[model samples]
Target: MDIVWFPLHITLFICSVTAAASEAALAKPNCSSHCGVLTEIPYPFGIGAGCYLDHWFQIICDRTASPPKAFLNVIGLEVLEISVEGTLKVTSPITFSNCSNKPLGLQAPNLEGSPFVFSQKNRFSSISCGGIALMTSLYGSTIGGCLSICDNTNTRVLQPNSCSGMKCCQTTIPLHLSAFNTSFGAVLNADSQMACKFAFLVDHDWFTSNSTNISAISEMDSVPIVLEWSLLDYTNFEIYGTNNWTDDKITNCSSHCFCSKGFQGNPYLLDGCQVPSSVLGQLFLLFGGWWSHKVVRKRKHIKRKKKFLKQNGGLLLEQQLSSGAVNVDKIRLFNSKELEKATDGFNADRILGKGGQGTVYKGMLTDGRIVAVKKSKIVDRGEVGQFINEIVILSQISQGNVVKLLGCCLETEVPLLVYEFILNGTLSEYIHHQNEELPLTWEMRLRIAIQVAGALSYLHSAASSPIFHRDIKSSNILLDEKYTAKVADFGTSRSMSIDRTHVTTKVQRTFGYLDPD
Candidate 1:
């Protein structure tokens, strides 16, 4: 009898193990935010006091309102909805990017160099066939971009709509797009059909079925996006693979960098710290730029980009093709559906951050593609179009300082973009966070600032086609495992001929990081 139960016991054991993992995925960590009403804030995000990663991640939680209200601190975009799947339906910065009879309307501000980014895993899609969309995101290394198309045809009348270059299109972004810019326009092409343009980084599941929010647009006014914000772990300063000599089991965090006590300097450094220095009253410091460097090519397949541009009708594109100085194959495109599964239906459980435009979540695809997901407000009509533009542009440019585009999705009502994930969160979180001050030391901050400058110069002056970062703040600049900086988020970015200095616009950045002008 005992032997007979062996098989059953083994089966039960496997089942129990599976159940545990699932529970962890479903279990929402205690750290959370409480909105006034109708909002639920979960882990990696918090409310006042111990509720968040410091004030920057705090939720307003104004319960006095009838329906309740929550908001991000940086950009006062009102919060409408919050979910455990790491997504929220929020109002757009300029909810309607249409050129209707109204005055020049409000537009989602450009969010670059901020600690936030459009979750490359999230979709910037539209609701119906009568609208066009534009969007932006953080792709590989913080270079911003856009995706747009003069969509108006109802491609989903008889079947599910796909962004297969039809009435729809999509684009990817630099990995750490902390913020984005938004705009909506009528169909610019004669063959294309469109009435209104809608944009936002949406939950593919909700967007595909016209999500409840879209269905109830006539009733409610706005929705909120849960931005999954991140910051670089202090570990990057640990001095891995260094030339310094040492062979001792030691920890340098001093228990301050989220480690146990009996520690010393910043855990991010090699010998973190041990009683100042034996040099008595003097301390030593190194002056090299980077511990190591990897030089990547800065050119794309000029022919392919020209083909895509001509197919897409980018005037600046033809010129690039003529130059025959870049390679496009290096750019990648990803599927929207895959990103959906990766983000667990854009559940609130995976959220790592939130900010001016939307919320961001951490995602792990089936093939182990880890990513940060940015969700924009439902009102940004240009969300989808901007996504497509970003993919097209990133694929055509090659620069060491620039982030690379991976791929994008547009099969559902909303569109989803994909890109390599940057592990760190944003500069805001690191610099101002009350958690621990050990990470942003003299060396680390300088390294970060320098890396950012390199990327900015590349985008402004070096990119084959002159590009504008538009928003060059700290949040959009993401950090990697080695603490190296990677520029991010180009949702509001624009491309122009080398001869042009600035594009026509009045899109502003967040309060603190705005341009001096």
Candidate 2:
């Protein structure tokens, strides 16, 4: 007993305790590991509110550009493509030699002012016809280039979008291109029989025969160009640590998607889209594949949604004749088209109110019943689909406080629940906006609260199956001109078996009045 345990064992036990404590104190990563699938609202590319840092990270959508360019704010750098691992394939514009009346030879364009620097790993990719393409840089630094090609008069040729020596001579400039003027010159060789000359930087893969074959002077002019850009002399680790973060990390992009800089891929073996370097690809991009992946996913998503609808009691609903004491036939089945007519395609003016569950619209039925319709935009959400529960709950109790369920329409893309229209505003409007607490009096607030509590107490205790009004916020409690309270918006309520007082479900009740448990 006096000797105690071994010294090494005691030391190990203490170390284990310290490690556990450290882990308990560790802070969670501030950012979300991945944005929702199909939703590309990445951290830097967020919606209205406080989603982004500032203007520097603006994702300017240029519909004017071919294929519509997406620029990253005031930096002036054009984003060619973004990857999941937080890397972007960008084009570094190089100043090619400017063609002029002067007799001077070729020189590198003025690339010194360019924010982007050329790297040995990148290429210049140029298309030419009849004339020489050259780039002249500052400080007397120069790089020269010459090109030649055949006429497109050959009958065996496919004159579509091609530029192979027959009419267009395609080539690449040396690495690390920056700042130079653009210019075109004649080679003055046997190929010099051509009248006009044309040249421009183009994506090696994007260059085509059309640039050369379709020209009036029979020379290539403006070719689609792509400049590969990366940080200079960065090790694998340093390249990944690019501090100039513009937008947030993109977890998901178009299919076969990878992350640009500032992100890494999923740590696991290629599960979701990520921005990892080693576990993910370094330089493997197929533009065609990336483009087509979206179409494939869109089709798949539509299928999944249909499947979810059928799974969530959609088929059971079609079975008809729910004999749970409630008059189930009172509820009508509405198609997406039917609801569009009823609410005028969910017109803004018809909107009564909006909540976490969905949008509420005012619609006039064919029989002239002006009803309030709650539409479930989130088809997968279980909250708005509890039509059966409401029908069951309403059938048992005949009460003045609870709003009557006029019925529901479920055959639509979104389930539309119809309730008796309460002409007066909500209790919140009286309490907050109109300062009803002052005008309506303290006795009115107490009476309204008591009225709401009584309605909920009845639902929770008296119904055949004990019902819990999961959402009980003041807004859900409506008030008539007579000051009588009528409980409304029981979107997330539960009707449990009398034997079992509570039921388990995916929690989607609104905040401020959510279940304590």
Candidate 3:
């Protein structure tokens, strides 16, 4: 009799567990979980007043529309998506310029005293021929902005899916950003009949995935932006009139809240997060193995980066900069991933030029700044010290005619150097391959020569250390949009102490331009 009873009791317990798991709640009892069109409005967000966790989570379902669209009542923005992952997607209006026929005011949403903040996944974007867009906080503080410029041509041909400061430009927003105002400066060539200029904050991923053509974007009234949501007090179960969840049931409870291991769904709702009885043990093992693998990979990646940093003379450069009077902040150490993304995985199309030392690629940084990245060929380990010294010397030299070294990336097998992007090509290109439309005039040539001589003089005598440009030719000189000369390519240059008159070194010069000395 005892054996039979034990078997029956075990069966009953299993049945009960399965029944409880199937009853996992998505929203408050007797509350609508979703509105028309949007079917996945998870808990923490509800359609009725008492259904939601708080006022901030209230969703007002407007039945006047054809499909009865849902809107976030607190912010009054149309809700596109609400995920348990603590993100809310909504449609935001675009701010048009005064010259545009559309409305001429800013769309500044006030999210103060709420749990929502603009996520970093959104980008501040602007569209104009030559205009500057600015984003400011509620307190009238400048947040960030970008400038978009284009040529004065009737047929403005913009590249499809590219926003590298042409007719369209994009920049990143600060973290924990809640509210902001968008305004535009004076447009360069404002035309009422032309496409109207506008600015807005949009989801970066969505914008990149969609057709970024001016016509397509101009047709749209609004764009989707993501907002990160978090609960200030998760332990306040009294506010919800429930005491079902304990501290052990939730994890990552600092700013954002998540279910513990083996649990799923909204952590803010009672019984909203649960695991099936049959797959409970399997999920535990799976999560454990995944977490372990992630940890191992992260550690390995960090170790590899540290090894590369030391090997590429990063440590030596730090020591030299600390010992000298040069400002260490002038030169930045960039990670390899950043440059890779900026250059679209270093695509072949981005190649600006190639030389014996390395190849130069045109890339746009996250801040909308155009830059030139130089990926060098493999170097001997013996020359690591010299490379570090050159970087130190370059950081100290500040001349208008010299190409500015913005930063370097030592994490790659071949080190990369970043410099300010020059709009025009090298002097050699202009001299060799002339353009009929924009020919190099004699006056421009004379001005370039004078600028080059001034740059060389600065390098030789004006700098803190006497430097010699072993290779100085037309190909080594770059021109800006205004035809100003910018001396470049310091790979073959050397620096000497102030006390020394001259130092002998191996001659490194281009053929047909060698000095007779």
Q: Which candidate is the best by lDDT?
A: 3
Candidate 2 vs candidate 3: the lDDT winner is 3
Per-prediction TM-score: 0.35, 0.37, 0.47
Candidate 1 structure quality by residue, lDDT tens digits, 287-318:
01111111111123444444433333344333
* Candidate 3 Cα misplacement greater than 4 A, ranges: 1-24, 99-101, 153-156, 188-195, 211-214, 233-235, 238-247, 276-517
Per-residue error for 242 in candidate 2, Å, reads: 49
Local distance difference test, each candidate: 0.50, 0.53, 0.79
Candidate 2 residues 407-475, lDDT tens each? 666555566777878888688877677763458688888888788778877877766656677777788
The C-alpha stretches of model 1 lying farther than 4 A from their native spots are: 1-328, 378-383, 434-437, 502-504, 511-517
Colliding residue pairs in candidate 3: none
Off by over 4 Å in 2: 1-312, 318-325, 334-338, 381-388, 395-397, 435-438, 501-517
Residue 123 C-alpha lDDT in model 3:
92
